[model samples]
Target: LEPLAEAGVDAVVLGCTHYPLLRPVIETVGARMFPSGLTLADGAEATAAELATLLTERELRGAGPGGLEMLVTDLPDRFAEVASRFLGEDVEGLAVKQVDL
Candidate 1:
C-alpha cells in the first residue's frame, strides 16, 4: 500500500466481496499513506451491474423479488449473524442450505 501510495495511485478497486467489510480500516490506512484522497471503487457493484446487463440482454432476468439461495459447504452456528452483515438485512428466518463438498 505504501509503495502504491508513493507511486501516486489515484484509485483502488475493492476487488473481493470481503473487501467492503474492511473499508473502514482501509480508509484509515489510506488516509495516513495517501495525503491526497484515494478513490475506492467497489468491484462488487460493477460485477452485479455487468451480470444484470448480461442477463437482461439474454432475456433471462426474472420478474419480481427473487428469493435468495445460499449454499454453504458447512453451516456454522453464527452463520446468520455473519451473513446479515454482508446482506445488510435481517436473515434470522432464512434457511441455511448445507452441501457436502
Candidate 2:
C-alpha cells in the first residue's frame, strides 16, 4: 500500500476471495495514505454486476431460481469445503460432482 501510494496509484482492486472482508480497513488506510482520494473495487462484485448486466441486456435472465452446480476434476471430498470458504457462503447439500476430464 505504501509503494502504491508512493507511486500515486489512486485505485486498488480487491481481487481475491478474502480481500473483500478487509474492505473497511483498506478504505480507511487508503484514505489516509492517498491524500487525493482512492477507489476500492471488489473484483467479484464487479464481475457479478457485469454478468448480470449482460444477461439482462441479452434477455437471458432465467425465470426460475438459479441452481448452482460445482464440478471438479479431483478431490471431491474437499471441493465443498474449499468452495464454501471461497464463496463465503454455506454450500452444504450442494452436489459437487467429480469429473474425469
Candidate 3:
C-alpha cells in the first residue's frame, strides 16, 4: 500500500486469487494513503466473465451440474480450506490433486 501510494498508482489490478479477500482492507488503506482515488480491478471477475462469454460464443456451455477440479503444487489441505471460504461452501469433497511444477 505504501509503495503504491508513493508511486502514485492510478489503479490496482488484483491478480491473485486470495487478493480479492483483502479488497476491502486494501481499498481503505489505499484511499487513506493515496492523494487521489484508486481504482481496483478484480482479475478473477474479469476472467470469469470472459470465460463465460467464450463458452457461450463457442456453444460449449455445460447443460448439467458443473464441477471444480483444484490442482496445486503444494498444500492441498490449506488450499481446500481457503478455496472453501472464497466459494462460500465446503470444498472437502471436491477433487483436489497436488502436482509437481
User: Which is the leading candidate under lDDT?
Assistant: 3
Clashes of each: 0, 0, 0
Tens digits of per-residue lDDT, candidate 2, 1-101, equal 89999998988889976689778889889889998999988989989999999999999999899988877886877877876786788786788888998
The regions of model 2 sitting more than 4 angstroms off are 70-89, 92-101
Model 3: lDDT equals 0.89
Ranking by TM-score: 3, 1, 2
Which residue pairs show backbone clashes in model 1? none
- Overall lDDT per candidate, in order of appearance: 0.84, 0.86, 0.89
Point out the higher-scoring one by lDDT: 2 or 3.
3
Output the number of the TM-score-best candidate. 3
CA lDDT of 5 in candidate 1? 94
Please give the ranking of all candidate structures by lDDT, highest first, separated by commas: 3, 2, 1
For residue 58, model 3's alpha carbon misses the true position, in angstroms, by: 1.2
